[model samples]
Target chain A: MNVPLPNADHLVGIVFLIMIGLTITGGVIACNANRLVRAVAGLVVCFVGVAGLYYFLNSPFIAMMQMLIYVGAVAVTISFAIMFAAPEESKKHGPPGTLAGPFGLITAGLLFGGFTLLALKTDWQVHAKINDGSVETMGKLLLTEYAMVFELISIVLLTAIIGALIIARRGRSS
Target chain B: MEILSLYNNLNTFLIIGALLFSMGVYGLVTRRTLIGMLIAAELILAGASINFMAFNRFTAPDPQVGQIFTLFIMAIAAAEAAIGLSIVVAIYRNYKSIDAEDLVELKG
Candidate 1:
């Protein structure tokens, strides 16, 4: 039995709007928060909303990876660094440069306006899809056509791990 | 209504990407700490990734390429975060503070 849901499309649209709201709200919190921990929390929220955006973009695998790599690993690592560095509350409460806030806002506003105009004015062309962009296709391409870059990424990750350990471990014995 | 179908629109994604990118720029400019700058940098990268994914979904001839590119972006972001945080730790240990203004030792 096919029951027609009249408002389903509208509901989905509302959900998308909510996701956008979540993303922007989190970004504002992350950028504007005075406390580092609160900023990190905002980062987490923003990433979650980005993951939802990825879902809307029709790539569930990338969305899951966004959650796993960004929210899980990156955000947690940042919080760990926050704990290690311990940015003091008293120190952070000092005044910022007089022109920094307004200057940054103006810069960002100009950038946003320019990009929005570009996106709106340009006639984006749609092309025919060769593959469905599924996990299977992604895996095959990763191992075949893009194998070199894949291997290189792994090497880079290894180097980063070793380098990070060495750098963070320095001056410990003194 | 047409607004109800905004998810299918390419401009929507592009606008969102632009918004995020600008926010990142604002954050990077205004933030006073190295780690905060790093976070803003991550936001910038995320905005770029979203644009790639949007183009992949709407316009690309081969969808796999964009997804692959985004995956590589994620890997690089992870590595960057690891390296950047470690550096933050090292800087804190040496200077005993992570404030960007305090590290102006070369202001000769």
Candidate 2:
């Protein structure tokens, strides 16, 4: 199967590099933006880029789910929260503390750089695989091996739904 | 050394996860409002999910394990967001402001 592998591989590599850049840039924007709503917008951009990376990782199902849940549902919810609660000023910068803002930025930057160095320097081992991580295999394993977790998550979701209802409704009475 | 090719490696995902986690941590520490903190918490959950997915793709005996675990994390994060938002709503009703600085009546 000597099918001119380098060309295809390099193309994929370029695409992957672009996706990684998009994700990192969006994340930087999300964390560092001056306005809260713009930060939320950056988060949506980051999530969409991460979904692209998931597709590159050979799990299209997870990638699609990532888009649906994070970009579609979660981002919308966060934007709604912003609309209702966050400040409308586009250039408020930050809170009133003098030293806190710069200190927080430097701390986050250091942590990110340290992690990048560690990840680049270390050698990782990949062990044998039981399955190829396909959607069919994922479904079978979910139903067969992780059934208990599936049921527990359903319960958790139900509780969250009820709790959200009660908490939001409590304000209506007053 | 093809280090820049780190973009194609599993460790790249791990490093990205760590970056996201630290951003979340920074946001959690610095945000003045409850909803902003909630957004940061979601970022932290996302970082954890990315780690699980990366390990699943690279090292695990059963690759589906990580995917399943990530799915569960997503469910949990959604639930957490719903509950957290509701609480924020209630707190806003009670306090008239959602600023973390203002909701300090319980402080001694």
Second chain TM-score, each model: 0.94, 0.91
> Which 10-residue window of candidate 1 chain B scores lowest in summed lDDT?
B99-108
Worst 10-residue stretch by lDDT in candidate 1 chain A?
Answer: A86-95
Strongest candidate by lDDT = 1
Error of 2 at B30 (Å): 1.9
Superposed model 2: Cα runs more than 4 Å off? A1-6, A87-93, A113-122, A128-131, A170-174, B1-7, B106-108
Tens-place lDDT digits, model 2, residues A13-111: 777778777777777777667777777887887887787777766667887888888888777877776666655535334763676667777887788
Model 2 chain A scores worst on lDDT over the 10 consecutive residues at A87-96
Worst 10 residues of 2 chain B by lDDT: B1-10
The global C-alpha lDDT for each of the candidates, from Candidate 1 onward, is 0.88, 0.76
Q: Considering only N, C-alpha and C atoms within 3 Å, which residue pairs clash in candidate 2?
A: none
Candidate 1 lDDT tens digits, A1-174: 586565888888878888788788888878878888888888888888888888888898999999999999999999999888964733583236998889999999999999999999999997655335479989999999999999999999999999999999966588
Residue B42 accuracy (lDDT) in model 1:
84
Pairs with backbone N, CA or C atoms under 3 Å apart (clashes), candidate 1: none
Query: Model 1 has how many clashing residue pairs?
Result: 0
In candidate 1 the C-alpha lDDT for residue B21 amounts to: 93
